[model samples]
Target: MTIGQWYNEAHRALRTASTAMGRSRALAAADINAAVIARSAIYTQLARATALLVGGSPAAEAPDRARATAILARHGQSLTQLYVGLQAAAVVERQFPASPATAVAGPARSLRRAVDAVGVIGDILASHVPPGQTPRTPEGLAVRAGGGVQSGLADIARLTSAAIMIDIALPGWLDQRRGHLTEIYRPAAEAARWTANSRLSAVARELIALGRGQPRLHGLDVARPPLNPAPPVSTADDAVAAVSAARTWMWQNPSELTSVHLQLGTQLGLAVHVLSSTGDPTMIGGWRQAAIAAADLRATSPVGPARDTAAELTEVLRWLRSIGKGNHGEPAGRHLQQVSRLNSELPIMAATLHKGLSAALQRRDLFVKDEGVLQRPAGSLVFRAAERWRPAMRDDDVVQDLVRALVQGQDADSRSEHRSPSSRAFPLPPRPRTPVSGAHWAGFDPPSGPAVRRSR
Candidate 1:
């Protein structure tokens, strides 16, 4: 038979097998690996056929040459589809590491990488030939073939190399995260229950010392200052001390405070203390501490950044619970509600903050009065408070937002002291809008049955 005809037959077999595999027929998977093997063998034959055809072999006598070339092209397309299926399957498999043995052993699952590499080579080979030209040499004269095989080999090598890199990197990361989830964090959480009731002051001191070496765990120190201190201290210094301690503790032993409750308690406790201090910088720092504290709470929560921030705002609610409208008036209510609104809108606020920060950096201007504030200036403030800051940008954003809320909340509290109820009720400026989908064809009306009156 002619080379083209043989390739056609091979192509037909592969197509049928692929269809069966798609339907997830057991018979197809059972023998799918064998089908790929057979397909690979046919590809080798096709390569040989092309070589023979290029060597001026007779059209009728050396039909295998023509058949191999055509078959290789068809097979290349089929294997491309096979590679796609394998990649999709791999993605599923990644999500379910303990998949059934049959899944692990299936042809689409196992030979996916190999099929993809080989398929890439086949595509290169297929493209080299002209559509109607007999793969056999013209006029029975032989010609030397070069580049086609080399190009295919190069493509196969590159794809195979990339596949190997993905295989190596993905598993290592997953294994590490799994180990943390299964072995480290889970056990620590169980142990934390026993430690929660320990002397808040003593625990605070040890956590502070532990935090000194690690700046991020600043909030964990339980000796954190009181929510509101008297005239002598100003409360802001105490808040800074609490933030410092908590930041250090959380940074070093983030594993300890895995739940939202712990995160909020740590943050608000620090905020209240910082707000009590007399110093301006310390008071401002208290605001930052509040924001950071809230962020830390969110970062540790199970609901991801969006829900975690909302959950973290429960700390603000806790703080409010302690001192309701005591001479602060409805302005306090408005401010608290604003904070609640921010907490509810954490995800969007977080995004806006990021964009604003980026814009500020680009504009080459400072948003705050102190350049040192923008620079993350150091002090015993965080060192003496609770713990150090947590790792990751999401954590920072949460803390920053809490700080903003505290600062703004205080401003609202002070401003409400002077403004009457009527002035405060006018709707505040609207926040930036978030994107949501709308129907493109919502307002469109379909044309009538026929343009009957068009022609006069």
Candidate 2:
């Protein structure tokens, strides 16, 4: 072949190789997204299935899949929001056919919608952040300005893993609803974590490289995480003491309770994780028992208002107790409104536990001799847990800004008509229509005062 022909062939080959590499990366990105979507679908389905089994109707016709795609394209979107929306839908769906233990269902949905709307708006506004605003990676995504690289990735890794485990084991978990989730899902969850890690491989690498000021970064980089990771369970008595202080702070700031509860649930979850990692039969058994108790508490029918938070707090408390209560810590937080049966006794109980845990560390140990004593290793766990346990609640300034921004951002701000989903710029699942009351079904007023009532 002539030199001209050879030169053309080499150029074409180089182009082909470059295109192939880009194609591979694109495919990996797609796979990560697919995994997330798959997980969300399973979550949504499980909720629907559970609702059906419990005599609840489907929340809303699952939006036409094609239509949903079109809607998503027209509006700004995020994987996290989409997943969260599906989760919210499933949770709301499950909460319907309200049992004795749930919140008074009717009026609360608007609040939930508003919360979701705020979250979605956060994603949307985040998208609009000017490129010049913050330090952007080569791929042009913001980095979490704060913490250790592994922590953020680890958060995604752990959360994604936990979700995957739940998705995988959900059917079984429901089928044997009485079984402890720790028993049913823990092992599978640990394994699923690696799977989540694998999915996040690309994102994690980008984060690491960025932290090190590497020149190479890509278009698909995830957003920067906060400086500190989401808090974990405190293992130290001192750390536990800090948690108590945080609770006291939260109590004074009642508005912060919801965030506290979310944090507590997370800490309790992480505590179980740390405990389980120890692998001792006793610790594992404690974790299992705690898990079972938690599952049982939440499984009770009629998970009314405080009962939900109560159940969650109780789960945390039970685990703490199982671990020998090296430090007195109470499971009080934002989500915990007054638990119904407590008759406002929870604070007293917490105070009492606080006093009990304050005693000599060895004395607190029901464990043999020094066996229960939290030594250097336990100290690290405690400090890490305490540091991580601090709630990321931004109730006042953060929430206010978000609410104002979303409202002002609405296309329907001036319109009297109700806003459509598209106007909000998020793809939140439809709120379930309120179940009509019996009075509405009868379509007639009951006899009123002065016995001027209708004849029976």
Q: Report lDDT (CA) for all predictions.
A: 0.30, 0.28
Put down candidate 1 lDDT per residue, 1-456, tens digits, no spaces.
Answer: 211232334334344434434444323323333323333333333333333323322123222323323432342233222222222212220111223335434333433334433443233223223234422111111112321222222222233232323222222222323443434223222222212222221322332343232211111112221232211211223322333233223322222333343335434434333332221343345344544544434223333332333233453434444434433453433333222222211221222232233222223322222112222237533423233333323223333444344434333332332222211221121222441111121222223232121211
Off by over 4 Å in 2: 1-144, 148-150, 172-456
| Per-model tally of clashing residue pairs | 65, 20
Give me the runs in candidate 1 sitting further than 4 Å from their true place: 1-253, 258-270, 273-282, 289-321, 327-456
| Minimal lDDT window, size 10, model 2 | 437-446
User: In TM-score terms, which candidate is top?
Assistant: 2
Model 2 whole-model lDDT (C-alpha atoms):
0.28
In model 1, what lDDT does residue 301 have? 37
